[model samples]
Target: MRYTDEELEVMLSNYRQLRSQLKDIRESIMVPHVIQDTNVGGSSSGFISNPTEMTAIRLAEDDVLNEIKNIGLAIENTYALLPKHKQKMMMAYFIDREPNIKELEVARRLFIDRTTLWRWKHQIISMYQIELEKLDSV
Candidate 1:
C-alpha cells in the first residue's frame, strides 16, 4: 500500500526508535537467569525449566525484531528510489544520527549551502510523494 508523507515520516521515526531499542533488546535476551533448584531428602537436583517470563520476553523480542525488519525494508525500498543527492540528503538529515552535527553542519558536510539544503529537502519530499504514489498504483 502507498503511504502519505506523514505516514512515511512516522514510519521513519519508528524505524529509528526501533533501531535505538535493539541494544536493550539484545541485553534482555542475553540476561542469564537461574532455574529454581529442587531438593528431595538429602539429594539436590539442578533442573532447568522454561519459565513463562523468559518465554514472554522471547516472544516480545521476536515481535520487535520482526517489526524492525519490516520497517527497515520499507524504508530501504523507498530510499532506493531516490536519486543519489536526495538519498545523501535524507541520510545526513534524517537517518544518520550524528549527535554533534547540526543541520547546518550536515549541509556543510554535503558541500551544499543551507538554503540549497532546505530546497533539496523539499524537492526530495516531493519526489518521495511521487514514488509513493507510483507504488500505490502498482
Candidate 2:
C-alpha cells in the first residue's frame, strides 16, 4: 500500500481541486433541473412531483460521487490528525497556495528555514499516504 513520494505529493496537491469539484457536484445534484415538456396536445395526469428531490436521489448513487467522497473524507481525516502547526504548514503549502509564490516565500511566511519546510512536507505527505492506505484497506 506504500506510494512513492511523487505519487503522494500528487495526491496532496489535488486536495483543493478535489474539494472544489466536490462542492460543484453537490450543488449540481441538489439543484432541481427544469425539464421542458415535449407533449403538445397530449393528455396529462397533472400529478408532477418535485423533480429536485428525485434528481438528488438519483445522482447520489453516482460512482464518481463515491470515489470523490472517499478520497475527500480520507484527506480531511488525515488533516485533522495533524498538529496545529503542521496544519498551518499544510494550508500554506497546498490548500491555500497562491500562484507565483516560491518555496522560500512559503517558508518565510511560516517563519521556518527551507530545510524545515522540506522536512515538514515530507512528514505531512507520509501521514497522508498512510491515511490513503487505510482508506484502501476499508
Candidate 3:
C-alpha cells in the first residue's frame, strides 16, 4: 500500500517499533546444534563432497534468518512509499506471495471490508508504475 506523507510517518513509526522488538528477540537467542559431525570430509573415496557440511548448513540457516529480517525492513520501507489505502493491501499481498493467502485473511488483517481491499489493490497497482518511476527518480 502506498501511503501519503502522513501515513508514511505512521508506518515508519510502526516499523521502528517492530524492529526494536525484533532486536530483543534476536539477542536472547542462540543457535543450538541438534546434530554434530565427527568426520571432516576429505578423500572419502575421492568423491565430490564438502568437509564442513555442518558449518555450511549453519551458515545457510543464518542467511535465511537474516533474509527474513531484511524482507521485513524492505516491506516496511516500501509500505511507507505507497498511498495510504494501498499500503495494507500491498503489504498483505507481499505477505501472501507464494502459497497464496486467502483474500479474507488479508482483509481481516487490514480490518477493511473485502470489497474495499480489492478495489484498493487494483487502484494501487494501477498507480504502481508511477510510484516506481518516482522512487527511481529519487
Candidate 4:
C-alpha cells in the first residue's frame, strides 16, 4: 500500500509508540498477579479471576502486535526498493535515531558533510514520495 509523506510519518511515529506499548504489555502479561483469598473465614479458599479484563488486554495486545507487523512489512517493502545509500541514510536518520544526534556528529558518522547530509535527506524524501507513487500505481 502507498502512503503520503505525512501519512508515512504518522504511521512511523505510531509504530514506534506501539512498539513501546507492546513492550509494556508483554511485561505486564509475563508478571504474575497475586490474588487475595476471599474465603479466609471458610474452610475452603479459591482465587477469583477477571476473565473479561484479561481477555480485553490480550485482545488489545494482539491487535497492536498485528498492526506493528503490518507497518514493519510496509516499511521493509519500501526500504527494499531503495538504493543502498538511500537505505543506509534512511536507516541512520530514522531507524537508528541518527537524526537526534548533533548534525556534525551524524555527518561524521555517515562520512558526509553536514550540508550534503541535509541535501541527501531531501533527496531521500523525494525518492520515497516517488516510490510511494509507483506503489500506488501498481
Q: How far is candidate 1 from the true structure (C-alpha RMSD, Å)?
A: 8.5
| Model 4 global lDDT (CA atoms, 0 to 1) | 0.62
Q: Kindly state the number of residue pairs that clash in model 3.
A: 7
Ordering by lDDT: 2, 1, 4, 3
Q: Encode model 2's per-residue lDDT on 1-138: one tens digit a residue.
A: 677989777767788799788878777666637544555777884433667655665477766766787777877887899999989999899778887999899999999999999999999888888888787787
lDDT by residue for model 3 over 12-103, one digit each (tens)?
33544556655654543433433443456764543225635644555556643554364355545566777776765675554433336677
State every prediction's TM-score relative to the real structure: 0.47, 0.69, 0.35, 0.46
Q: Which candidate is the best by TM-score?
A: 2
**Candidate 1 lDDT trough over 10 residues, lowest sum:** 32-41
The predicted structure with the larger TM-score, 1 or 4, is 1
**TM-score for predicted model 1 compared with the true structure:** 0.47
- Which scores greater on TM-score, model 3 or model 4? 4
Superposed model 2: Cα runs more than 4 Å off: 1-3, 26-61
Root-mean-square deviation (CA) per prediction: 8.5, 5.5, 11.4, 8.6
Candidate 3, run of 10 with poorest lDDT: 28-37
Give per-residue CA lDDT, model 1, range 1-138, as digits (tens).
556667765555465766667666655655636433455657654443556665455646576665555566556776888789878888887677466777799899999999998887666556555655554454
Q: For candidate 2, which ten residues in a row score worst on lDDT? A: 30-39
Q: Candidate 4 on 54-100: residue-level lDDT in tens?
A: 54555565655555555655566767877887677667766666335
Winner on TM-score between 2 and 4 is: 2
